[model samples]
Target: MSTIDNTFEAQSSAGVSGPATRGSIIARLERLPANAMLVRARILIGLATFFDGFDVIAIAATLPILIGKWHLTPWDVALLIGASSVGQLIGAFLFPWYAERHGRVKAIALSSGVIGVTSIACGFAPSFAVFFALRIVQGIGLGGELPVAATYINEICRAHGRGRFVLLYEIVFPVGLLASNALGAWIVPRFGWEAMYFIGGVPLILFFVLRKLVPESPRWLAERGRMSEAADAVHAFERTAKTALPPMGDPASFESMVARHPKRKMSDLFGKAYWKRSAAVAMLWMTCGVIQYGLSTWLPTIYRTVYHAPLQLALNLAVAASVLGVLGSLLCAMLVDKVGRKPIINWSFMLCALSLALAGVFHDASVYVVAMCCAFALGWLACGFITAYVYTPELYPTSIRAFGCGVGGAWLKLAAIFAPTLVSKTMIGGNLDVAFYLLAVVPFLAALVVQFLGIETKGKVLEQLEA
Candidate 1:
């Protein structure tokens, strides 16, 4: 039918010593039964991402109030947001080593527990320093969850449908934002800003469920030559699938199965052959972090200040826009498998950039159109990174995939650390248009880099993508 369908039918295998065929992956997954296990995996990971999205963006929506309450200068507000990014940067680098050692599912579970505890702590912190401290801890959890989720999905997903699966996983981030924004709008007026964190801490519920339900990545076991354990894991999955009454592929005997190819080192990804890709994806993620956090976080503030929307109205709009943003994540999930990751990202970034430019320059547009366009821009821009979330894992092998996603993500958080101040300064200096224009420029550079250096990862399996 379609390219994606054809690819799914073919089952592309990149790491197992053969050419990637698009049909094989879909066929493999088809053997598994339809049941609660897969659903649980998606929901658990998605819920974590949802909390992350909320944690990442909540500051923006809450900032104006914090400013008023604490007598905050722009610089102080920037520092508050930057602190979390710094934690994310550190966590991104460190989590890979831990995930490599401990396993992806375990890392995620630990991060979830960390986020949950830290989030509740943040809610009760009586001072700015304590609040900021909790954010750093919260960020560690956020940063670790991502690479772990990527590795987990990559390990379990069928090759042909992997892109879509990853995209779906990525959707949780935006969905989390939607939930947070809505909750903040409702809770902030009733219970004060701190209550949002109490609500955000609800993800702790996921932690207990995760420990009981989520399985360790079988592929990780295979790579480590723990074949018996790997086979046991797969057998557990197949048995679970069979009980659910779905067709499944024959479970390969662990003893008969060959181990993964020789371990690919983290350093290899930065060498000549892959350096170009590393740069492109890194820059793409960096640019996305700058633009996304800068805009989405500030939208409610802008509405309150420039448009003179009431605080309640501004918060409502932010919450509404955040909900609408899920469309972008869903769009990426739908199209990334078929059209290819590069084109979607290239075009999505371009559209996002253009919309931001228009929003900034056309100060006199009808309010309804401005609302529609801003929502559209946020949705489009949000998708660019969502695609990257799925695309990044595909660029490196299983041995180093966690590392690759981690490093790329570290740059993104680093970019985000600076963007809040950059946007604030530009807006405060009466050059808001300039900020939008600058944002537009970064994506163009990002698109050019991708055109020249990006890799196509539509149908390939995780291990096959490695050098």
Candidate 2:
């Protein structure tokens, strides 16, 4: 039998704990079902993610006004839209590495605090240059919080129900994006674009609740060999035990997770043990970025340029499309646990590619707009975008979970940085089909990658995945 099969022990807890083996934090957490503590943690994390989602699409939400007032050329449009994403690399690479060494809680707190300050500053920028710099700062905060937060949420969830649990909390991100689009539709046109920034800045105050509300991931603590700290964190995450814990070993003998899964060098993320998983996730991230980001940031611009949509109508259409995006994301959150990650991701990406391709072939403006709406729904709800977020962190052990997630996120941001640039160049005049056709190929490929390479993580323990 494989180490994975031997270590995981058939996923049955026997519905009771002997208190001795219960001493292991992983055994303790896995035994319990979801309860109040997890609920509160999700709410707290969801609130931060909601704003992160809001700020992520905030530029796109207000793109019409930026293009008009600033006289932004297509190239300038790409820079303005992609600037925050440029800074995401730093947040994605740096903070999660820090979290691996320091802790998940502190990393999240500091990152959230940075987002708050930068968002408020963005509201008052004097020029496009100042605004661009402010966005980079905000992206830093945005990038830092997500991967670490994902690690904490995933670790605390019960293995049987982990996908639904984590993805449900993740659903807030799209809702935030939808809300930003709706808010910008109403506020940016009448009240001006700064209103969007001001609203985003105000949410920074919620970051305070994170430290007091959510506990560190016990799995992470255990991986670090801080067993006592892991125990305390498990207690903090679960106020009461739901069932019997695993059996402890004889007093003189100890089973060692550290020995079984030896410490991987930082460089090993690209080596034999993890490279396939990493490549699969990275490719998924990039394709989702191209498919989703390419369309998301440019939808309103596409609406105006192609159909000659008026400002209010353009924003209104963008808001309506986001409604589909939100519903699709919620659908993904609901089905991920039931349907399993690989099948859902495979089919979703296939549908996303089909939608984009259909839209590309039909040159009619009405067909194009409706096609985009279909693509948004299929991609956000089922395609590998939401699937990737829930699946990527599960692939690595806690030692590099955050780093793995961070790199996955960084690739998406890097794609976001380029997607808009690519779309901007082609979206002018009647070349819009070029952008759609370009974006379609990757999602189709992503579906195949998931089929062959994506691991089924729906009900598996985090540690068992690497085993």
List per-prediction Cα lDDT, in the order shown. 0.74, 0.75
Off by over 4 Å in 1: 1-35, 242-261, 364-371
**What digit string (tens of lDDT, one per residue) describes model 1 on residues 1-467?**
76444333332221122222222222234345544567678888778877888878778667778879878776787788887888888888878768888788777877878788888888788888888888888888887788778767766776667778778878888888887788778778788888888777877887777867876776776666554445444444544553543443333322122233455788977886579879987888898788767777877787777678888888888876776679887978898889999999889878887887787676556555556667777888877888888888778766777888898888888898998898789868977767777777877788888878998878865555655
Model 2, C-alpha of 275: deviation from truth (Å): 1.1
For candidate 1, give the lDDT of residue 23.
Answer: 25
Cα deviation of 459, candidate 1, in Å: 1.6
Per-residue accuracy of model 2 over 317-411 as CA lDDT, tens digit each = 77777777777777878888889998878877777777777677774758346546444644443446777778988898878888888998888
TM-score of each: 0.88, 0.90
